[model samples]
Target: MEDMDAGRAGTARRWLDKLRGLIDPERMGDDFLYLLYHDALARRLGTCHDQRDNLYLRRFERPQIELFDLMAGHLPVLTLAGRIGGALLADHLAGRDTATLLSVGIGSGGQEAAVLTALAKRGRAPGRLTVIGVDPAVGSLHQAERAIRDTGVTLDFHHVPRFAERMTDQDWDLVRRAPRPLVMNAAFALHHLRDTASGADERNTFLSKLRDAEPDVVVLCEPDSDHHRVALPERFHNSWRHFHAVFRLIDVLDVSAADRNAMKLFFRREVVDIVGTADDEDRYERHEPAETWLARLREAGFRPMPAPAESVSEPMPPAFVRHDPDSVRIGFDGESILAVIHAVPAHA
Candidate 1:
């Protein structure tokens, strides 16, 4: 009887933990920012969520600076970006006796370009790198062009006047008509489906085409947060906590009281921010869930290579509530720099 009771108790505890993980009903009343109100008499112990929003990235100018610097401090994403990009280029077009390469969009902060540069710096760059950037956004192409000029990577950018979602069979045919074989990488541009009309089937179909075309490798970054919805008050709590964690890592969140208060107000407003449009709108757009994406690479016949999760911030208590397309995505190391990728097999 004693042994049986102990087993039952253990199972019960596990179930309870799972249940609690799904809900945030601690009966903490209806306050959004604080766990409890004080008459300026008690110690200011904070809820776990406060650190994310109000406390971190509170400064306006340094929002991304706060993120990248902090994430790089804890993880290798920054250091690896350039090296990976370079290696990818070499692997794809190395034997062709050509110095040409292809790329999509400007690439996130030029991570892939930096990687290629590092490779060339070590004497591995193509003699005349031909880079073709395809995006309807001329601005992004210009940024890529500017970087190419500054980096002196022999580049030729084609303003393919269509966004990824907007790219049709004819548009891809145009890309296929390029002189050099396209060995490209998409840093994080695949996630924004043309504009909602995309569900799982649509997403799979599009990725299938990309695989058929067979780029050098398609690298991407997508959200890892378990999608959920939060009430206005819960949004207040989660955003603040994400901010705190980010600022603490950057260690430059010091701001005036007014600025700090303004941030809090900004987050408070986003609680009602219409995240994704209606479900009917889901046909052309689909958000990639992280775990599902890992499976997707393998399903698409790409090999599995796990991106480091150390960039995730210090773990928060399982978030009680979250929103779809949560604007504030915190990383494993505390910054929002989550990414993963797969290179095409040599034979493929």
Candidate 2:
């Protein structure tokens, strides 16, 4: 048993060294680096030697909604962002007689439900509310519908089961013709749109479309990491650093060890997508820095709104909130992990 443990440790050390080597600037053009990345991820996931020919081909249990609910209850970054975002949305909805909310990538509707609850508490909910949910996953849309219904806020709900980027002309028309004072909530979703290439201009097309919708307020929550434009080596380094912080945060969560491990494991797919997708077209988790997003929003004819007022008197330590001129950033240990931006038509 001792010898087996030593062998496993040695293999892990070798994998770590290989991963480090892949991030070296001098090794940028190495053709074999992609295979190394794949194998390294497979090894780390304990599937490199599995009977399945490919790591991805092997079936792994998907993280359940209960697990995510557990994480949301304990993860400061998530809880804070949700609260801050809900507050901002509720603020925007205040004093509106009729309003429509277009939620891009409205996964499971947890955030929207929270926003509705906040508005109800403030007694500022619109007299007639219309929520348009766009997402590619039918299951998520169903879950979102249920969640929205549970809020007990009478509203018209439209589910557009399509990727935000791939929404049909009719679908967009639905948004354009929705109730007045249209507000959009795109939380951790836009980064999935495929750009022409790393650091390319294709993203601008989508942003321009968003501007055309003429939303009264657009609330965006995105990671403050540069996984989009950089090449694989830099992407690998960035992902490693970013997820290391995330995993460490998870470690201190007051949850069962198994639950904590499951939460960490849920993020493994993101790391793999960041490093393993050799072709830029195939990569979906292309997170850009907050600065990039801000610039893009401006170029798309949206101006940032004032940062949301700090509501929490004492944020948990290690989780700091920074109000920048253009957006609100939530970070752990001084590293900005997520940014919440409120923007509107420059002319608005």
Top lDDT prediction, candidate number: 2
User: Which candidate has the highest TM-score of all?
Assistant: 2
Q: Report the Cα RMSD per candidate.
A: 12.5, 8.0
lDDT of 2 by residue, 45-100 (tens): 45444242234222323457766777687889888888778778887777688899
Lowest summed lDDT across 10 adjacent residues in model 2 is found at: 24-33
Q: How accurate is candidate 2 locally (lDDT)?
A: 0.75
Q: TM-score for each prediction?
A: 0.54, 0.82
Screening candidate 2 with a backbone cut-off below 3 angstroms (N, C-alpha, C), the clashing residue pairs are: none
Report how far off residue 151 is in candidate 2 (Å): 1.9
RMSD of 1: 12.5
Give the Cα lDDT of each candidate: 0.44, 0.75
